[model samples]
Target: MNNKKPALRIGIIGGGISGVALALGLCRHSHLQVQLFESAPAFGEVGAGVSFGPNAVCAIAGLGLGETYLHVADRTPEPWEDVWFEWRRGSDASYLGATITPGVGQSSVHRADFLDALAAQLPEGITQFGKRATQVDQQSDELKVLFDDGTEYPCDLLIGADGIKSALRNHVLEGQGLAPQAPRFSGTCAYRGMVDSLHLREAFRVHGIDEHLVDVPQMYLGLDGHILTFPVRNGRIINVVAFISDRSQPEPTWPADAPWVREVSQREMLDAFAGWGDAARAVLECIPTPTIWALHDLVELPGYVHGRVVLIGDAAHAMLPHQGAGAGQGLEDAYFLARLLGDTRTDAGNLAELLEAYDNLRRPRACRVQRTSLETGELYELRDPIVGANEQLLGEVLATRFDWLWNHDLDADLTEARARLGWEPRSRGALRQG
Candidate 1:
């Protein structure tokens, strides 16, 4: 038997889905000792609605959590029906085409349930909650992490799954004489909320909305603003998000809490969306109270990995939610890292090589998605002919763009890496668990 001491001790900062999912990916490996640190009070995730496309579903299913995910969440057959649009010819309205066919199969879920499934798959006694990682120190041999409560831990590798506002990102860049910037407002504020489908239907009935309003996701576009709505939780609830680019003075800042705590009342919503279609008006009216999230995005890092520390998810490349792949890409990062670390040739001397391979495999693809998502955001705000043309092209070209992403198999990469290093495969399925 090829018995060798486990390659390295791994430490993960931040206990979000990315961290926990990475833990599950690394579970079958007895070669590495892993620790996950979180700032939250408990070992779970908190959030509202999110989408999981087939690419994301493939990653999760590969982790052996598909059945568990379905048990705790809704599994809709057709989650994405259309990308609706409204075009105005000098104030005259027209219904632009709704791109019904999508590149990937998708399902919506309450974000909390998705995280719970991943957390359940994690090995026991490995997660440390309420222990906020305030700092990371890169030593000559290992990386040292310091918590807010003055406790310290060390490991051979450090993974910053902390989030967009990652402390490790700053530490690594500053260590290399580069300063990282936090995400800033994108001049758009989103009003997000979820309501029961029955309530939505009743409200629409009294207000005279389109009969097909509840069928699929609907996007109402205007000049510099847009409204998006979709069904979730087995179609039990409808989630709505209204994005507006206001010209007035910027709004006041608020603490990071549920998106609903800072809502501009129903009256305010009506004022903002007064000129929108009646269907959107009814959907907005049905929302109990909408929480507002100021949209923000981060510029791509020049390097995603450095020395013993590497960044993943929002920490490495935070993008706008136009494609709804922020969380999915994070899951991809976790799975990709599992492939790298579990490789037969993954030794201390070649750790840098593994990191480079990971960056090379992911950065270009992710950056393309990031740029396309931004373009989609601009497309969503269209009230012009150009946007209509772009929408048609988007529907036609989406599949081509996502082919490599959706078809990627980390096991293949791991196998390739081992072959490149002249190592024989010990077991076909040893590198991956699910």
Candidate 2:
């Protein structure tokens, strides 16, 4: 007589970093049947370079992707391994301050490369591509995920790891009789491109700018704009994102049907930073082709959980990129959710409560990060009324601004989450410590 408990059918929407990471974490358990549906035909990530602070690094490690991440992630060389970014005035290159984050400073990876590394680790027959989810139908015991192709998938639990424009988010909001919220444009557009590190070094030297800027990450701040550069691909390339903001409007806005990313000419990028200092101009000149990205973030949701459906990553709390914590928060989301769902005590009868515990533990922290990210962008662009470009005050704020975000203890949070679920705390060694 074979009397085994039925496996839980877990469906994950979207195949971005958080989705795949969560899938990987859940797959570690033999009883959880995980299936990942991606809108794209294959696993991929868009964007040039993504940096992770110490907090993100720990989350990545906690998710069992530490080796893969470290394999491709670029870190500052010795003597500057702790420097997050050196801040300078965009007009004159005068040093403002430097943010030193010990152990993991400006660690970054090309988006595509990191995603590829993560995708390689997935178990076979786990992911389906070209499957764009349109809506989710919640039944009494199971949820039906409808795709754009007129097909549907029935699962025990559904998780939305989709990007800013999420279909399952609509289901979650509508389930509670609330209207879905659209992503709000932050009135900031980033001009992004990559430059050859060696060539950029030569350009810096030719323009009589410090070559040291190329060796480590640097942020040049202006009145209404800021330019940041960090090494990627093992320092072979320098990724640059130059941001220009329009703050005239009292409230931020973006056309509903407008595209978020588009290609723009080098001339347009140059004109935006026309009067910047030699170092800033040198970095900009290296990129003959640049693409502009309209930055948008989601307003805080009332909750991330509604019955068996949950939202993670950008679907829950998309934010500005100023603090470089967006992806990290997503990874943290994956870590907590994966740990909670994979707990031995978690089962079909208690899944909803476990999810609530996950939301209770994660929602507040992620929303705080989201809010702080916007404020950080304002601080970066010198829009803060109090700081107002005061170099001394800016320096002091920069030194400790990321302390809370970076110094977070994920294990403790996991313990608290277990407590919320009325489960006894497990030792750190007993759980997968990444």
Candidate 3:
């Protein structure tokens, strides 16, 4: 009789940032057999620049990717290339108030580079590409996962990090007296792309804006929406994102089979930011072809755990990008959950309780960020129901609203969560956010 125990099997759907992060974290502890599936044929086509606050940078660093992240990230510090965020009255391009901060650790990275960094950290043969998940069902002893290729994987636990339109999300919500929900557009769409810094330099230089200032981040506030621009790829290119609330996506629901990204002409982009400042217009001029992204967010999920399956990242709580913390929140989820699951003492008997603990701790925080992101967008557009065109309060709102999001301490949060579960073992994989 062979009595060797089988390893705990973990099946993760979707290979976006969050899924990849979780796979990397679980791989740190050899007891877990981790497998990640992606719908795409391969990784590294995320199609945009991602900004991570100091808090998220610390999370990435704690995951043992700090040095690699520093190599691939845009860490151009301030005083040389200081970050300046100016809130100008959108109607005429007048400065409201400005906040200056050193760009030391708030790393903005190319999505491909970031994904590549994460994918590289995983052990060989762990991530399987082109596996689109079709169905997930919990059986008496294990969970069964089906793919489009007519293959099935039965595992001890399942995680649906599949992203906004997750098929696994649909599975978890099935038969809960809740009709599966689809993502709804936030009444806004954005034209985003990478613009060569040379084009922006020429545009700003001709306008008498300092050439040095071209590398810094900028925000152009307006009536219906705003323009946010920042440098990425080591200042080789600038990422430009211009958002507008007027663009009517009448069918606000995200189409399942349709591409969320489509090409938009320069004329459409120019017309979208036409009424904004010279700086905003200049940034728009640099984008020859822009990819329009319709922002969609979920209303809310009552919880994040269903049986042994848990939802993370966009699958659980998708939000607006106004805070630039959506990905950060997802990374936080990966790290926090990984710590709980990595504990050797955690067994099948307590797996349900531990997952419920994850839901109890993570859901409120992620959902709060979702609500905060919505409010932040309204404030940026000067259309806040509470502010109501009050420019003075708008400045106040922009100045310190992000302190909580940027300076979060993950180690402390996990400690509190551990106490809530009434189990405190010596720290294994947890690290304080430095």
Candidate 4:
């Protein structure tokens, strides 16, 4: 008689990059049953672009996607320059200062293309479309992911990566005697667009500005806000992200209100930056239609795990995008979780220890990134009185601000964690197919 135990059944909420990556990584075991629920009718993304740093590339590489990811990613224009960032005054385009990233470089890609690449890596029949989870209920032996379709999926573990408006996140918070909370606004709004490279080059030529600005992305700084520009798609396009402290709206944002935060006309954005210099105007003028998003992030959760379920990515710790680490942090989460869950020694009966290990390693690091991202924006907008004191200090501060973030090695971290947690390493070939 066969006396072996059943394989772990893992259910993931959200089919975004993080969720799919986690599922794909875990599926390499072939013993773990991984299913993902995506509320969208099909897998896709609606955003303009994302900035991927070396750490992000390494994290994706851990999933065996480093080369595949490079196909869609463009090496940002910082490799040739000694300094990585050129901070400039938005009024006259006068260079305030610049910061150098000694080793770190970034790759930018369209959000849809990245998402498609991740989805393409996932196998068919694993993701159930239009399945929006309403609530997660944990019983004695199994966890139930209740959906809006009056159906429930039973799983041994749940990973919620459903993003900023996640529905399953409530269960994790509520289990800890905490009231369900939504992401809070940071009194900031962003207008985002992508400008064609040829278009930006012509705009710079017409403005009679140094052509170097297009070669290396520039950050035009001003009072209460900043504009960040970078190249994507092998310098064929420029992604423009503008941040402003918007006080035009009321508190506790309600999306039902017409002309809410998600949508803003190009004229409104132009009006907001009316006094900016030519560079800002040049990029702004190229954006035929601007998409606006009210930046909101989660407060630190008391814990990321509850019983058989856990949270990852934005559902656990969404943050401001000032440092461009929001999605990258999510990727990091998937990397750790996949390795922990896929370990041959890990079994469904001992999932609590696995989850505890995840919380111990991932929570602290992700929260630090969240807080750092917030403070970074403050510096960019000259809100931090100290960083705003002088441009030289600002340049120095920005230069080294992200070194620790980019230099982290997940493999080393995993080794340390195993030692710290008394986990025994197993041979990679030992993973049995269920």
Clashes of each: 3, 0, 0, 0
Give the per-residue lDDT of model 3 (tens digit) for 173-202: 773556687887787888998988898899
lDDT on C-alpha atoms for all candidate structures: 0.69, 0.89, 0.79, 0.81
Write candidate 4's Cα lDDT for 295-367 as tens digits: 8898887789889889999999999998889899999999988887787777876788778878877888888
Among these predictions, the greatest TM-score belongs to 2
Q: For model 3, what is the error of residue 214's alpha carbon versus the real structure, in angstroms, after optimal superposition?
A: 1.5
* C-alpha-based local distance difference test score of model 3: 0.79
lDDT tens readout by residue for model 2, 1-434: 98777888899999999999999999989779999999998988889899898988988888888999989989988889999999999998889889999888888999899898999999999999999988778878668889989999998899999989888888888888888898889899999999999999999889888788999899999989999999999889999999999999979788877889989999999999988998999899999989999999999887888889999999999999999999999999999888887876777989988887777778888989998999998898888978988889998899899998999889888886776677876555543221
- TM-score order of candidates, top first: 2, 4, 3, 1
lDDT for 11 in candidate 4 is 94
Clashing pairs in 1: 62-434, 259-291, 260-291
Which residue pairs does candidate 3 place in steric collision?
Answer: none
Query: Which lDDT value does model 3 have at 234?
Result: 83
Across residues 35-128, which tens digit of lDDT does each residue of candidate 1 receive?
8888888766545877765677766766656676667554334444323222221122234444332543445677787787768777788888
CA error at residue 281 for candidate 1, angstroms = 0.5
TM per model? 0.84, 0.96, 0.91, 0.92
